[model samples]
Target: MTRLRIVLADDHPLVLMGMRDLLEKDFSFEVTATLDSPTALVEHLRRHPAHVIITDYSMPGDETYGDGIRLVKYLRRHFPVPRVVVLTMVSNPMIISALYDAGVSAVVLKRHNLNEISAALHTLQAGRRYYPPGFQRDGAIDARNKFIGERINSLSPKEYEVLRHFVRGESMMQVAESLKRSIKTVSGQKISAMRKLNVQTDQELVAFCVTSGIFP
Candidate 1:
């Protein structure tokens, strides 16, 4: 039998090491690479192929391929062969839905046993999407999550950047400077994001971001 080729990427060194050990212990899985950043993963994929790619949702410090939905989209666009599984601590239904929409094959919450990673890979082998337990508990919850997910997805890339900066405690001027946009433009983007998210104040926007796990 052929072993499943796997690539693991995570920002945390300990988490990456743990995942490598867990997957390697399984005789059917082969970890071809363990990367710590989005850039490294992309570079590795350019030269090596894998059957599965399990990665964290947020691996900050890679400006070329910013984390979250952005990184997922990039991987799907550039390397569509490997199945992508997101292993993250983020539990916000809105973000989870967004990740699925971005074309990941599975999402396993880190709070669960790491063994779920193997289960996720098996589900992918069967050509099915895997969701964490209780991810689709009821119609009412799905409806609410769908509504918020739509709102969150409506933000343009620039608008999302504005919110990410704000959540990181950056001032409006700081964000504007960093993005090379005028203060007015940055503020406008912030307002637009707030409107889409139905947040009325800066505090509310930050609170929503934190609770939604958009930055985490």
Candidate 2:
């Protein structure tokens, strides 16, 4: 059997290390690298592309940046053969939908039953898409609705627009330019949106949206 070469990336040290150990212990996989940042991981992909990329959806310090969605999009856009699987604790529809659209092979929540992730990897190896064993069972229709509803109930249109750009790791100036609105307009929208979203800081807003799956 040709061993499937892989790389694991997550901002959390323990989580990153644990995932590497788990994959090595439980499967016929060869992990080529484990990285703490997406920037370094991207550079690694440039040098030595792996068969798969197991990435967390969120990064602690990076908040909106150095995250899995953008990283996966970048990998799919530029690299060869490395399929991405999101292995994180976030269980939100916006998150699910965003990662799904980002071209990941799988998006497995960090359920206590992480064995599903192992299964997802094997399924990917066989040229198939994998969702967690009970993603549907676990997150019933109501739970999914709750996430979407939260976004709907919390943010206004302009705030939502700011969030769309913000979640994808865009700068405030970039958001202003892209929306063709003034920085003051963008700044006001952001502040209002943050209040509605119930977040005090921009970093928290990004994390909330990512966790909620509202931001790309």
* TM-score leader: 1
lDDT of 2 by residue, 1-216 (tens): 567898888877898778888889755798889998877787788889688888887653443334545556677888747788888765555556667777888988776576776888889878899876555443445876765557545555455656677666778897776566798898898888787767898788877777765632
Question: Number of backbone collisions per candidate, in order?
Answer: 0, 2
Clashing pairs in 2: 94-213, 95-213
Question: What's the TM-score of each model vs. the native?
Answer: 0.76, 0.68
RMSD of each: 4.4, 5.9
**Lowest lDDT 10-mer window, candidate 2?**
60-69
Clashes of 2: 2
Off by over 4 Å in 1: 138-162, 170-189, 192-200, 207-216
